[model samples]
Target: MILDVQGKAAYAYTGGKPFDASLPSTVFIHGAEHDHSVWALQTRYFAHHGFGVLAVDLPGHCRSAGPALRTVAAMADW
Candidate 1:
C-alpha cells in the first residue's frame, strides 16, 4: 500500500491482506540496508491471525520515496 506520510509516498506491505483500520495494528520497521521483506514471515503471521500488519520500507529505501532522513530525530519525526 502507499501512504502519504509527510507529503512523501511511503510504501507498506500489508501482509498479503487488504488493510483494515479497525483491526489491531502491528508496524514493522526495517533497519538500514533492508526493506519490508525482512518482516515477511512475521507480518504474514500477524496479519493472518487477527492483526493488521504494516511492514514499511522507510524513506529512500526500496519502494518508499525520499531524500533519506539524515538524523535520528528526523527519522523519528517521519
Candidate 2:
C-alpha cells in the first residue's frame, strides 16, 4: 500500500492482508541498504496471525518517494 508520510509517498507491504484499523499495527523498517522486501516473510507471518504488518520502504528507497534523510535523527523524526 502507499501512504503519505511527510508529504511524500511511502511504500508499505501489507503481507497480503486487507488492513483493519482495529488490529494492532506492526511496522517493519529496513536498513539503508535494503527495502521492504527484506521483511517479506516476517511481515506475512505477523499480518496473518493478528497484527497489521507494515513492511515499509523508507524515503528515497525502493517504491518510496524522497530525497533521503541525512541522519538517523532525521529518520527517526520523519
Candidate 3:
C-alpha cells in the first residue's frame, strides 16, 4: 500500500489478506546511511507471520528523491 502523507510519498507492504487472523502493523525506520531496503529481512519475516510492514526510504536517500548531506539532523529529516 502507498500513502500520500501530507504530500510525502510513503511506501508500505502488507502480508496476508484483509481480515487476516494476524492483523498487526509494524512501521520501521532505518538508521542513517540506510534506507527501507535495510528492512528486507525483517519485512519478510514479519510478513510471513501475517504482520503488515511499512518501510520507506526517507527523503534524499536511496531511491527516494531529495539531497545528500553530512549532518545528523539532515539525515534524520531524510
The root-mean-square deviation over C-alpha atoms between each candidate and the true structure, in angstroms, is 1.0, 1.0, 3.9
Candidate 1 global TM-score: 0.92
Lowest summed lDDT window (length 10), candidate 1: 68-77
Model 2 lDDT tens row, 1-78: 999998989999999998777999999988876899999889989999999888888898899999877788877887
Candidate 2 TM-score to native = 0.92
* Most lDDT-accurate candidate: 1
Taking all chains together, each candidate's TM-score versus the true structure is 0.92, 0.92, 0.63
- For 4-48, candidate 1 gives per-residue lDDT tens digits of 998999999999999899999999998777899999999999999
In angstroms, give how far residue 1 of model 3 lies from its true place: 4.6
Better of 2 and 3 by lDDT: 2
Evaluate residue 2 in candidate 3 and report its C-alpha lDDT on the 0 to 100 scale: 51
Worst 10 residues of 3 by lDDT: 12-21
- Clashing residue pairs, backbone N/CA/C < 3 A, model 2: none
lDDT of each: 0.91, 0.89, 0.63
Where in model 3 is the C-alpha error above 4 Å?
Answer: 13-22, 68-78
